[model samples]
Target chain A: MSPKTACFLVIGNEVLSGRTRDSNTQTLAHALNAQGIILSEVRVIPDIPQRIIDAVTECRARFDMVFTSGGIGPTHDDITTACVAEAFGVALRCHQESYDALNALFPEEAFNQARQKMAWLPEGSTPIKNTVSTAPGFSIGNVHVMAGVPSIFRAMVQWLVPQLEAGAPLTMCSWHAFNVYEGTFAEALTTLQGDFKTIDLGSYPFARDDKHGVALVAKGYDSHAVQEAGRALKSLLTQIGVTPISGEPAP
Target chain B: MSPKTACFLVIGNEVLSGRTRDSNTQTLAHALNAQGIILSEVRVIPDIPQRIIDAVTECRARFDMVFTSGGIGPTHDDITTACVAEAFGVALRCHQESYDALNALFPEEAFNQARQKMAWLPEGSTPIKNTVSTAPGFSIGNVHVMAGVPSIFRAMVQWLVPQLEAGAPLTMCSWHAFNVYEGTFAEALTTLQGDFKTIDLGSYPFARDDKHGVALVAKGYDSHAVQEAGRALKSLLTQIGVTPISGEPAP
Candidate 1:
């Protein structure tokens, strides 16, 4: 199956200002990768409405699915929902189901006025159930809108990924050798990468005390081809006078 | 001094495809923070020239300083120099100084052939000397363009930050409590945050061994004010029937 492409729009001033370390990008990348969807881009914009609208429109037009996290809170800076609606040329309206859920989660005095903002949704957007929070995330077109909080974002992504079609996952295998230099293995690695047109070989050099080495990673969609290429890599490394670590091949 | 705001543009198809995990953004964020410049946005766009132009133009207009990483390689995908030139309404041409530096790094045969692309620069842009590599980074107006490789990007940032105007660095202090529930401390923490108008307070809840607690972090430009607010926090926690951990008192 062909790979499906996805993009992530992280809307928050906190993340860009280094006030918040983003865990959502990593979470989305891993989840999408596991589902055989290639996450193609990530853009972190501020709470600006125009910026959010522009990025959302561009990503949705370019990729199979576009996911956005953050800026759904009740604060003045929370404008993602409205911006998204504007991007899709839809009207912003209160989602009754979401409002009812929020109303049920808190006292009438505490939640009535303050939590109503969380229920605001774009016209024709379907709510993506939030198992952790009463404020439900929403989906419109191919764009899935979720929370910025890592835990909530994770839960929402898990709930949403299963509903979409997934492509075949890329298979990857690696071999490691210590006490070797990157320069020593660069030529062979480049040649192998050239020979295997479909496979991508990554050479990662790590620092170690008397144990320096390169981690040769082979990545592609074909499992058998990757394993065969890995064997060839091992043979090449051995011929080049490098010691290979023996282990069961990764699945 | 008001905190200086900066933004980063990471231009690369590799990053967008998740083929490369971005270290450039984090490195710049940390380095800029140390120099008292707050990084306010990071946009990762593909190698498309139009997107690069749009991101650079918009970011430069919004922030005090704009930094761009990636798309400076020798490959055909490297279009940042030309796009940046277009964004600034300048011309793209080979830089003699950079060409000389590249020649010095390698023999003329190797440098003139493969590394010639490194010599291209936006007309009238000043080169930021790269201590690690021959491909010099450059700056035009308030936008600083650096390489994609982590080591070189870091070196360029370190060299570039000191040359720019820096605002006062924000001082950060934290108070941690063990075996205390967030529900118990929520009210007190909220009160403390309101009382400290200058400080930005963040309460992070964590679960440990089935116990709940929070790590209260206070950040601001005034060290004395943070300490004062921290003292009030410890006092409030103690009054709320929680034992203070060692180092709980304001330093």
Candidate 2:
């Protein structure tokens, strides 16, 4: 299958202001990559309604799917749900099923007061079940709106990813060479990368305990191609007179 | 002292495509928070030259400082230096100091071929010396352009942060209560949060070994105010018959 592309829109003033460190982006990226759905863009915008609407609308048009995190909480700053509704030209109304779920956990009178704001959903959107929180998430078209909390966001990803068609997972292999400078290995790595047109080759240089080394990672969809490239990489490293550490096979 | 605000522009297609996970944001956030410089915003844009220019220009106007990661490499895709030059309306040229450094590291002819691209910097920008690699980073106006690699970015942060003025570091304290659900302590935490106007309180609910609990964190500029809030939180937790686990004092 061809690679499926997606974008993430992280909406929160707290994150922008660095009042909070964002963990959701990394979590989503790992989950999507495991399923072979490439996340192509990530935009962190403020709580401004107009910005959210514009970002959601633009991202939805460009990517196969758009996932948004934050601005669905029970605060004045939480406006993602409404902005998403406006972007999709849908009406914002209370979802009865979500209300029932909230009410089932708490007293109706109290839950109504706390969750009335959360029940607001975009027209024609199906609610994404929230196992971690009373405030349920929803999906409008291909845009999945999930909570900002890491635990809750992770739960939603597990639920949502299986529903979407995933592309072939990329296979990767790495060769680590110690006591080697990046400059020394640059030519060979670059040549290998050029030869392997379908694979992504990355040279990550690191300094540890007064020793410098580079980890060469090769990634592609075809397992045979990846293995072939790995064998070539090992040969290249040996020819360069560097003892490369052959680690366990890449998962 | 008034709060110092900074913004980060992460320029890379690899990060946006989920090909690489970003650790620079968290490292910078924690480090900057310790120095009392608040990170106001972070935008991860692609290698698109126009987008990089737009993000840098806007962030420079909005925040006291702007730090950009990625796009500073020897490859063709590394266009951050050029985009930054365009943003500042300056000509791109090879920095002599960087060229000299590269020449010292490699044969003159070989250095000229590979390091010439890394030497390209925006006119009038001061180079941020990279002790780790030959690729010299630079700072122009209020924007500090650094390498995307985590180690290089981190070294730049350590080198650059001490040169900037920092506001008072915030004092933070936490109180944990185990085996107590958030519902049981929600009202008290909310009430305490309301009473402490100067302090910012965050209630985090966690599940551990089939048990639920809440961790109440209080942060503020004033040490005494944080301590007072912490004491009040501890008393409230005990009053609710929830056993409290006191953590380290606010730093």
Candidate 3:
């Protein structure tokens, strides 16, 4: 069966401006894979309303599930909630449950309008619980709006994963050899790939510890196919007169 | 002056599979900002033809320039050159200069079809020099194809940046205050943002060394406005009874 697909919309001017390196994409990529869902695409957009609307609308229409990280905070730049509402053509309203949760967590004196903005959500959307902070993320349609903070984004994914339809999980095997060059085995690896059409092969060359080498990875839904490909890859490496190392090389 | 915009298309299955962390995007983001070009969008896509073609076609149409990284290597999975040609409805052909360069760099005995594939480029696309590796990346129209390897990608970008139109460089100033929360300063920061409409303000909260704080960054084309915003942010922090620290907190 074809795996369920997901698209991650990473919203932030900080990432576009080079002020921050995005860790959320990688985190979601790994998590989604573990749940058998394919992360088909990831787009990092700035904190602009129209851009967010465009991305959210496109992703929600294309993928089975859509996730967004960033711009859900209580600041002037945090317009993700409103933009998402605009994308769905819904009005932004204060979610009673979320407002109650925020009130229970924060002191009455500390409950200011800016902080209160966290309770606002697109009409008909439900809240995604945020254990990291009092401010909860919300889900509208198939789209889950999460925090930009890595810790919070990671937590939100852990909560959202079980709710989505899971597909066949992808398994992988790797073989690496030091003092080897990709040009030496490129032809052979290509031939091996043709035979195992179902398995996806990747060649990543690296230079480390004063040695150069390549890591050959085989990944697919079937463990047996992945293993057979790994074996063929090792035999191919042996034919090229190189000793293959199992697993990844030590960094 | 408004900055020229560019969108990055990061094509690789390794990144989407979480097998590798993409450092190329961050490297390019920093370089583009320094050159005054606004990196308006970034899309990380798997090494699939239709997806690559869609992303390439869309980004090329939307932005002033488009840059793609990965899937240009010699391996069987490296289909970027062919897919990019299809995106522009052009034909892929082996560029003579690139072929000659590759031949000169590698031993004649090592030269094979796999290595020869690196010379292929879309019609009318010129080669970008790769100092780290002999394999040349290509640029067709506004799209610049680059290597996935961080070292090679970095070098290729250094060569391409000088060729593009540079915009007014963005400048920024930052203030950090410990033992303060976003709630403590969200109202003040919002009011300050209204006064300095030209400056882009960001509030990044952090917890470190057993203390919580927020980093207020003010960015804009005008250095004077950024300075003014920084001063106002510091004054706001002082009003909240916290002395602001200039620069990032120590790790």
lDDT of 2 by residue, B71-175 (tens): 787644567898999999999888888877877877764663445778878999999878777678899999999988788898888888777787787677778
lDDT of each: 0.74, 0.76, 0.88
Q: For candidate 2, what is the DockQ-based docking class?
A: acceptable
TM-score of model 1's chain A = 0.90
Model 1, span B8-96: residue lDDT tens = 88876545544456767777876776778877778777767888998888889989989998767554345788899999999878899
Q: Return the DockQ of model 1.
A: 0.23
Model 3: native contacts recovered, as a fraction: 0.60
Candidate 3, residues B1-251: lDDT per residue as tens digits? 68889999999988888888788888898889788898999999998899999899989999999999998888888889899999989998989988999889788888888899898888989999999878999888999999988888999999988777887778889899887778767888889999999999899887654667788899988889999998998898899899989966654
Superposed on the true interface residues, model 1 gives a C-alpha RMSD in angstroms of 5.3
Candidate 1 Cα errors over 4 Å, as ranges: A179-188, A208-213, A222-225, A228-236, A244-251, B1-5, B11-24, B34-38, B45-155, B167-251
- Clashing residue pairs in all predictions, respectively, total 1, 1, 0
Model 1 clash tally, residue pairs: 1
lDDT of 3 at B150: 86
Predicted complexes: DockQ each: 0.23, 0.27, 0.72
In the predicted model 3, the residue pairs found to clash are: none
RMSD of each: 5.9, 4.3, 1.7
Q: Under CAPRI classification, how is model 3 graded?
A: medium
Candidate 3, residue A34: CA error in Å? 1.3
